[model samples]
Target: MIELRSQQGETVDLICRRAYGRETAENLAAVLDLNRGLAALGPVLPTGTLVRLPDPPADPPRVAVVRLWD
Candidate 1:
């Protein structure tokens, strides 16, 4: 599983984009159904808190899974 870390004021969308690519924020948001307030992302994720970056999924299936942040 990938570890999602927040960077002062980092949003769910920003996490996705940074972990994957520039165009992945929105897509990842859609996958998580989190349009706003991504602070509830994990047990360790706090608002504007610094966290780790989840690893990007490999090619083939192209699935953006929130499980990575576990």
Candidate 2:
């Protein structure tokens, strides 16, 4: 687990992106689930608020396979 303090006017999305390196919709939702109280606070997060970040997966990041053309 990682611990970080919230900066004034920072949003959870920004925090997640900075902390986890991936701010995808799924990741954002997962963060909200972990921080239930912040979910209710919306985009603006108070300064100096303590936030806990979940541990990153031990495995390497997953790669997506994209399809191009039709």
Query: Best candidate, TM-score-wise?
Result: 2
Give stretches of model 2 more than 4 Å off. 60-70
lDDT of 2 by residue, 1-70 (tens): 7778888888887888788776777767776767778766667888887777777668747889888976
Q: What is the C-alpha lDDT of each candidate?
A: 0.54, 0.77
Candidate 1 local Cα displacement, residue 34, angstroms: 12
TM-score of 1: 0.40
Q: How many steric clashes between backbone atoms does each model show?
A: 6, 0
As a whole number from 0 to 100, the lDDT of residue 50 in candidate 2 is: 76
